[model samples]
Target: MSSAGRVPQGLRRVYLNVRPERLGVLIGEGGKTLRDLENRTQTIVSVDSLNSSVVIEAATPETPIEMVLRASDFIKAIDAGFSPERALRLLDEDMVLIIINLKEVIGDSQSHLYRVKARVIGEEGKVRTNIEQLTGTYISVYDDLVAIIGDYEGAYLAREAIEMLIQGREHSTVYRFLNKKVRELKRKRLTEYWKKDFSTKEVKS
Candidate 1:
């Protein structure tokens, strides 16, 4: 069958597995998020509550291709540790960072890298927020790089703190002083994310 004719023959189905709880968030209040996605990508998105999977069906080959690409990007963002509710927050602003030379301290295992990155970002990003608040910067700890976004002064402070931590600074010391500085910065905060695009774009292009 021709591509156009085959489109209706189950040729445009994309499946996504999401957590049961997240399904509601993705669907949004009154199905706003789902409807937006469908309207934008020109694909019909249906959720299967029984299996917690999303099915995307396109009316045309072109639409399906675009839908798949966009859907994959969304899925990747979620799999990379973002909540569906907060996914859009990252779409416009870049909030990720990759720290180099991390392997030197934590070794190259995937699990170890994640553990170290978690340490850098902290619980619910509290640590990172402190760094940004103190330094007037936004920090994102990714696989192999620590990203810093903010004004010069804030970035400098954050960089220094990260360096100290990596050089074996005691967590207690880092936390105490870092918290103080962030508070100060918040009062005088005047910085921003210099590189405003997500880190993925940097690597891809």
Candidate 2:
């Protein structure tokens, strides 16, 4: 975040493990996604399809770890079932990713996981959409996992909202909770805005 567009010259040889199937997403079609990421982050991102690992290396051993890690997070998001486009949002300093493991809550029953996933998904994706709309996040319900992408507050709020649904909480109750969270987030943002404005004025005075 603090690094913004700056690429440091000391970060090197960081590796992250990803699913082999996900390598396609990380590399993108025809390697377009891979090329785009390398260009944007100024680093070399190598995907080993056989081993299901990604190496984020400095193009010149000078690329900063922060940038590499940022790239790593983006790829992780994709591996977690987020689309590559949505994964890119992690490039923003304030963006956060939260993954909820259905297995942890519901145990090893495949039927239970499927049922719980549907519950979070709602009758026709309505529940998922509502949660995303209210929290301003992207939600992915896939293979016993619930993945969310949003700013700090939105991601966690969405995660809890989804978890409640999986936990058998009433839909209406979860909606209400999300509504309160939205209001709280907006108020906090406004407060921060005013504080920043006031600080600027103080400096001028």
Candidate 3:
């Protein structure tokens, strides 16, 4: 849905579409979720269920578009198969959403795409679960899309692992790579934290 001429003068609005089946999830039980989102963002979310459309309008003319965008992202995460609680994590500034389109990688071959998707999912969702646990990310395989929500580094790492699966790498190989890289990342973060702490202590001394 386009907001080009629909928005009133001096008002900021964002338009987005949720999957028809996910619209109720976006709205929440008895509108509780939608109300919470508006309360937090200082925006009004208008849902057009018939069209699977959502329009987020600033409560006042002074509201920021950033807030609107954030709300949009939250809705999108839900549409991509995240529960509201998981999608709410995007409210944190460091969190992000990354989507991988399987059709693009597998070149319109449904059988190839199915195989790749299976590789990412593994038997009983073990592969997907492993990547999420190791990387601290949420992975959702819906249709031909893989959606991930996490901090930037975690999301990127998850994306890489999925891509490797698509490229026909052995699952064991991917798991090993993830384990090594996650350790490296932890070490790097620890080093940075200690350096910052040392600097603070030096200043105090």
Candidate 4:
């Protein structure tokens, strides 16, 4: 199936592809995971294991298209190596999945891609762990793709750090950048919260 894009608003169907190996993860033991997804999104998910294709259809006319898209993203995230628990975060309104194609970044050369993946992953997963901690994002370095799941700001920050590492930046440098950005993000959020709270009080008065 071709990559899914925004469709006209309404109950609709979407198709996504999953790797054959990861189908079990998507299905879960006894189909619990897939059922949970369908329940949460109010959609029906059908899997074709032979084709590694998934079809998601809105369960009712009242079902929102956004929910359908969310299901699609949830599957894509898991297919990209995110654990089911981590992928579930996409159900949240603020959480998102950001994937970086290593081939697009460096090249199609397997060795080159492997080297870049190693840099993002670091030894013993220290770098990936640090990035996740610093940006509050969950990252997966799977095959030739690096997937990030988090709020938009955190996910973008994590992506930036990974890109820096891919560009041969020192690990320490990437960490510093994340640290600075994360602090700024916190302050911005605090400022926005107060502004919103003040406006609410003003209207109440």
Candidate 5:
């Protein structure tokens, strides 16, 4: 048994719609991602498996502002839908996907496909990380699809860099510009990822 003050208190809730398939990724291994989000925003994030919705509970008055902001970020990503093209656009980069219908790249086994994906992701995810940091965008490469998420300027820069890479531009060149871009947007606000306040509680029917 716990004392009254020791018991946890409930906060305001904000709901989000998420695809069933991507739910696991959002939750992560052992709920790692969910826990990270909760710690960072100081909120309680509960997911309803049946409804495919997320409930965010603010820990305090201050928590509501941050919780809503973070919740909005997740909602936007979910609502925008998954498109390698759109993700790159969100990252402010122009990108092209070399669609290979088969699971493996020509002359290589499935393992080869993994290598190619790794090549795009780069060392310790440095390549993708640099792109996101510089352009203030998000880049995710899954299987044969490479998703880019950022604003216009970042997208433009990313597009040029990606095109150059596809055209056989040296990795060094692409990485250099990527670094520069990261510095540029370091303090920039990504409005596209921003969500308006949803702190108000839902009215009961």
Candidate 6:
């Protein structure tokens, strides 16, 4: 398809401007990640190196809206700072993407972005790793954006934790909050499991 054919017949396209430095990460080795994404989502993906823009289009009229949306989401996730591997999780029905724009919080004080991002990243990326492990999420602190990929429960808790950090809440306080949330999530998962098990047993009987 010609680059000028921006709008494929019976299909829609989503254009995203990716960071120049991160473009290689999005493209991956020899375009393997890009091809994998296209195959998984059944969408045509075109990356313009010079412009650092990506175009995602539905492969056919029969293609589901969800497929297109997921593909778009995956690209946006990469733009938002997530690795392509983590971004691919957007394809999962239960996984979600969340991006916190530092500009929203920093307003005109763009300089504050570096400090806030640093706090989330911690001394050696330990804080970020802790939050991911505690909340079962993947986090990426890139440029002026903080990106997260996880299931609904994990994403919600991780997002909250991240916001607290961005707000300059004490690190210890955030750690406690995450610990408490982790237990709550574990309990909820156990309850759901028991309910599902009971239903299965009843059906068997």
Best by TM-score: 4
For model 1, how does the per-residue alpha-carbon lDDT over 1-205 read when each residue is reduced to its tens digit? 4454234445577677766765776777898877776676567878888998877677465564645445544543443344454444333323322234577766779886776677777788877777666665556564465656444555567777887776667667887877777777665543323344445578789
Per TM-score, what order, best first?
Answer: 4, 3, 6, 2, 1, 5
Q: Which candidate is the best by lDDT?
A: 4
Which wins on lDDT, candidate 3 or candidate 4?
4
| lDDT of candidate 5 at residue 135, scale 0 to 100 | 68
Residue pairs clashing, model 2 = 8-64, 9-62
lDDT tens string, model 4, 155-187? 998999998999999998888888889899999
Distance from true location, Cα of 48 in model 4, Å: 0.6
lDDT for model 1, please: 0.61
- The better-scoring model by lDDT among 4 and 6 is 4
Clashes of each: 8, 2, 0, 0, 14, 0
Report how far residue 198 has shifted in candidate 5, in Å. 42
- 2 or 4, greater by TM-score: 4
Q: lDDT ranking from best to worst?
A: 4, 3, 6, 2, 1, 5
Q: Per-residue lDDT tens digits of candidate 5, residues 89-170?
A: 2221232222222243233476765665565668898877766666666665654445455555666677666555544567
Q: What is the TM-score of each candidate against the true structure?
A: 0.44, 0.87, 0.89, 0.92, 0.40, 0.89
Report lDDT (Cα) of residue 79, candidate 4. Answer: 89
Per-residue alpha-carbon lDDT of candidate 6 for residues 157-201, written as tens digits (9 for 90 to 100): 999999998888999999999999899889989999999999999
RMSD of each predicted structure = 11.3, 3.4, 4.6, 4.3, 14.4, 4.8
lDDT at position 205, candidate 2 = 100
Candidate 2, 1-205: lDDT as tens digits: 3664445544466778887777887887799998988887778888888889888876754566667777877887888888888888888889987878789988999998988988898988999999999989999887767899899888988988887888899999999999988998899999999999999999999
The lDDT per prediction is 0.61, 0.84, 0.88, 0.91, 0.56, 0.86
